[model samples]
Target: MNAEMQVILDQLEEENLGIRKKAIEALKKWEYQLELEDACLLLEKAAEIKPLCEDEWDNPSYALVTAACIFIHEDMVPVIEKNILRYSLRAAIKVLSFLLVLNTESAISLYKKTFHQFYDHGFACTGV
Candidate 1:
């Protein structure tokens, strides 16, 4: 991961909406400029964040998830896990559905463990 990317990610927690926005944009730019593995690490870190607000537009976690979608997908799984409570239930579901499209196995497993009562019966984790 780029050291500069981590620096910008730190700004996401800034209370100033404008500062977070600029930081989000800068991180998004790195999606194009950085190598895929480094970018993935950057985005994964972003996903680990929990936004403080419900405003999707100003929520850096949401912005990071959306922006990182273009270059990173698998890393989003943990993001959904960690930040599920930070967002409203609706927004949380939306992000999960998006992850399902990107990586179905991880998303479904996460969904089952968290929400599906039958999940404990015998739904297995498969490579497919």
Candidate 2:
């Protein structure tokens, strides 16, 4: 809703993945606070953007993970964790790595939860 948020949202909507990734990084670094409604709106808008084609260097998955890393409130961690599991292990690992860099406690908790879920389902990581 603020001018800064509007600009960031605009950048996220840009056709170039680089621009969107930059915007996501900036948003993460700035760590701006938003009202729940405003944050949800921005996240919804971000979700509308399509993922990049295979040839694109800047993957939208990075932005999505960055956004989740930056914007996840304490109450939203469970939801984000659920969403993370829907992604490939590589993608989930990348996102969890970022999350760990940003907030270790939450990241560890999510990792434990995800690991349990996977183990219960007979899923296992194939490589070290």
Q: lDDT of all the models against the reference?
A: 0.56, 0.57
Alpha-carbon lDDT of model 1: 0.56
lDDT of 1 by residue, 7-26 (tens): 77778877777787788677
Stretches off by above 4 angstroms in model 2 are: 16-31, 36-48, 55-57, 86-91, 94-109, 116-128
Candidate 1, superposed: residue stretches over 4 Å from native: 27-56, 71-79, 87-91, 112-128
Superposed by TM-score, candidate 1 places the C-alpha of residue 112 at a distance from the truth, in angstroms, of 4.5
In candidate 2, position 34 carries an lDDT of 71
Task: Give the lowest summed-lDDT range of ten residues in model 2.
Answer: 55-64
User: Looking at candidate 1, what is the lDDT of residue 119?
Assistant: 50
